[model samples]
Target: MAMDGKARSAKAALKRQAMKEVELRHTVRYGIKQMLGDLMHWNKISEMGEALQLLILNAVPESALLYRNADIPLMPAEMIRHHARQGIQDRLDDLAGQMFGASHKHVIELLILCAHDAGPEGSAKHLRIPRHEITINENVSRKLDQARIREELRMGRDD
Candidate 1:
């Protein structure tokens, strides 16, 4: 039996999955990167003050921060001295916990990237291309089981 009352799987996938220190560090850093990316994409966090609050408070659940409007507490003038301190490295390790879940880095990169680059495309001009010549038929791409298993009755084919 599993700790959660669920029966343990005979294969025990968790037992086989172990991350080395290098791989684990990379995974954690990547998760941190993605966490900040997720926030920047939605434009929630802007400054170090916000980043400090989010990281310290553990409000980031599931690798994403739950936005509480205008609730971002400002870092006091005293705390600003160690904005990117090493002490918080431990917090960044589990920034996105296995169960629950940025920083000064990813947000800074995005702020610069968005400022310099165009939208997703090389240029920002909206694509006004018409969709007529796009000849991919929707039906061809639909699910193979689109036709449900109706009652075993032999119905005439609508097609």
Candidate 2:
């Protein structure tokens, strides 16, 4: 009987140790998942900002020139600020569709700053910027054409 009691106590101790290990594993996995989530969120925001900047630079050569020259006047700055605010608002509205959580607001703000411009195109109606004006840079125009071709190829592949 004494031996049996000792064996039972040992079995219970082993079970407790197993439970503790399982808990530790779960905690570690949770931490890793959270870190990955944050990293992915940051990457998405960075990519969006890059794409937006490319769009803005390609859309408004005058604004891009001002930025490149670091000679943006007060009027241009105000217009850029207004566009940035609008971009933020648009991002917020589309957040739910993008499956982004609360932390994404900061990311959107960062993207807005990188993509803001204040040229004639900025004042134009949405989606109304002339393709000729938007494609002022020959290199950017070639790249845009290539991208369109690639997109078309992808769509064809899907079919």
Candidate 3:
């Protein structure tokens, strides 16, 4: 009976470990999707800030940072010193590369520039060529607002 109980305990432990891995995978996937939207300034991205905050905080792992910064004009040394932290950098370079492609660095640079730019409405532009005009659909905006409210309510209940 003890041996059977031990087997059940081990099985339960494995199940918990698997659940944790699944959750991690889901979070990573969701983060990447949101990051892509943030970079592109597309679809519900305006409501999210995690990716931008990570960049602003310079808190992405070093591997992802180096990958994101590849082949781009270096940020001013002062900006780098002020923005980035010195610590153990990880080796997740492939994550940025795979998710962002070759222009990842340039995109990040443009984002930083936009953040610092203090100009009148028409003074600056996003980094994309053949500049497409951005228009928010009112219907979509209403739906997003409703969704946000529902999410807040759900979160309140969970808490």
lDDT of 1 by residue, 1-159 (tens): 335434354234444333211111121222334433444344444554344434444322332332212232233211121233343445554553422324433323223233223333421221122235656577755543354434223364543
TM-score of 2: 0.17
What Cα-based lDDT does every candidate model obtain?
0.34, 0.37, 0.39
**What is the lDDT for 1 in model 3?**
29
TM-score, every prediction? 0.20, 0.17, 0.20
Question: Which sections of candidate 1 miss by over 4 Å?
Answer: 1-47, 63-82, 97-159
lDDT of 2 by residue, 1-159 (tens): 356888997896687565442111111111223332333343343343333333333332222233332332323111111122344344444542343342332233222322343223342221122355343688888999999999999999999
Per-candidate RMSD, Å? 15.7, 22.3, 17.0
Cα error of candidate 2 at position 7, Å? 71
List of clashing residue pairs for candidate 2: none
Which residue pairs collide, candidate 3?
Answer: none
lDDT of 3 by residue, 43-70 (tens): 2234223334344334233333343433
Model 1 TM-score is 0.20
